[model samples]
Target: MSILLILALVVAMGAVLYALVRGVIAMANGKDVSGEVQQGYMQKRVLYQGIAIVIVVLLLVVAKSNGS
Candidate 1:
């Protein structure tokens, strides 16, 4: 159970990193970010990151609660 949580967190973080890098690369290419498509992608990425953070916090809280 704990192992599953750890693995999920790792995958989530890796996905977050991948999305961030892709965004950075697109921006670096001098592509305009004002387009709706880019904005949507950015929004989705933010949502993913937010979800990841929530999951991580919850996992840590649960682990601490159990450890106590």
Candidate 2:
């Protein structure tokens, strides 16, 4: 269970990082339509970060239950 939690956290963080970098690159491109692309990436980054947070909370709950 701990291993699974670690892997899930890693994957979620990686997704967030990927979206962030893509958004930055799109913004830097300075094209007229880049705003829409950046917005999409920003949304995806938020979603991934949210998922990571939820997973972390779940892991903590599981650990606490097991300890008791």
Candidate 3:
């Protein structure tokens, strides 16, 4: 179970990184002058960040329970 959670955390972190880089690239490219494309990526990044945070909290909880 802990291993599964760790794997999920890694995937979530990777998603967050991917979103951030994509968003940065889109913004830097200036292809979407209206900023719509960048906004979508930003939203995805935030969502992934939230997921990562939740996973981290779960990991902490699991660790605490195991240690106790």
Candidate 4:
């Protein structure tokens, strides 16, 4: 459980970070983007990625710990 949690958290954080960086760059470049467009990207890329990664990491960690 713990291992899986860790993996998930890592994945989640990584995804969010990636999205944030990309989003910031896009905004900095002065691209014409709508509120929905920005929000959609963040939610789909960062939020979703982060959640998925965290869950996977946590599961892996927990499984390894238990097995060991």
lDDT of 2 at 21: 100
Clashes per candidate (backbone, < 3 Å) = 0, 0, 0, 22
lDDT of each: 0.75, 0.94, 0.97, 0.68
Say which prediction, candidate 1 or candidate 4, comes out ahead on lDDT.
Answer: 1
In terms of lDDT, model 1 sits at: 0.75
- Give the alpha carbon lDDT tens digit for every residue of 1-68 in model 4: 47556766776777777787776666676664565556665666756675776577667776878899
Q: Estimate each model's TM-score.
A: 0.71, 0.93, 0.96, 0.54
**Lowest lDDT 10-mer window, candidate 4?**
32-41
lDDT by residue for model 2 over 1-68, one digit each (tens)?
98899899999999999999999999999894738999999999999999999999999998999999
Ranking by TM-score: 3, 2, 1, 4
Q: Candidate 1: misplaced stretches above 4 Å?
A: none
Best by lDDT: 3
Per-residue lDDT of model 3, residues 1-68, tens digit only:
89999999999999999999999999999889999999999999999999999999999999999999
Q: How close to the true structure is residue 5 of candidate 4, measured as C-alpha lDDT?
A: 62
Q: Which of the two candidates, 2 or 3, achieves a greater TM-score against the reference?
A: 3
Output the lDDT of residue 49, model 2: 97
- Measured with C-alpha atoms, the lDDT of residue 32 in candidate 2 is 42
